[model samples]
Target: MTQYEVTETSDVKGENCPMPVVKTKQTIDQLAEDDVLEVLATDSGSVSDIAGWADTTEGVELVDQEGDGDVYKHYVRKTE
Candidate 1:
């Protein structure tokens, strides 16, 4: 996985479903434009959830996603 210059990191390690995506959105909203957010999550569902959310949402981009067993890492960027 390529390293990203993340402006913030949101750890939702044990959280599941909406919590991961919800927290990601909230955190991303607080970031400056072009800032990158690194989201660490343990729930496997977050892989697809975050991607889907980013895909449909405006001003947010899903830069990258990586998974290692139960741990998942998502890099999201604030485009606006």
Candidate 2:
């Protein structure tokens, strides 16, 4: 199992694009190695963006994802 912290959340209920991805990255960076981060976003694009970022990045792991309606949650584990 992975431990996660809700580092940041965006109420971008009506926002779109880059903002969601940008904010998610910002929060992911704040966590320590092996620590997981949970990001709350409202942008649909974040699903691909966040997953892509973790898959392509060398030191990040996209652990899981879940969403309810407009709110999307992403879990990322940092790797050193």
lDDT of 2 by residue, 55-78 (tens): 888888888888989798887777
Clashes of 2: 0
Alpha-carbon TM-score of each model against the true structure: 0.93, 0.77
Q: Which candidate's lDDT is highest?
A: 1
State, as a TM-score between 0 and 1, how close model 2 is to the true structure.
0.77
* Model 1: per-residue Cα lDDT over 1-80, one tens digit each: 65569999999998989999999999999999999999999998899999999999999999999897788999999999
- In angstroms, the error of model 2 at 34 is 1.0
Give the CA lDDT, 0 to 100, for residue 20 in model 1: 99
What 10-residue stretch in candidate 2 is worst by lDDT?
Answer: 6-15
Backbone clash numbers for all candidates listed: 0, 0
Stretches off by above 4 angstroms in model 1 are 1-3
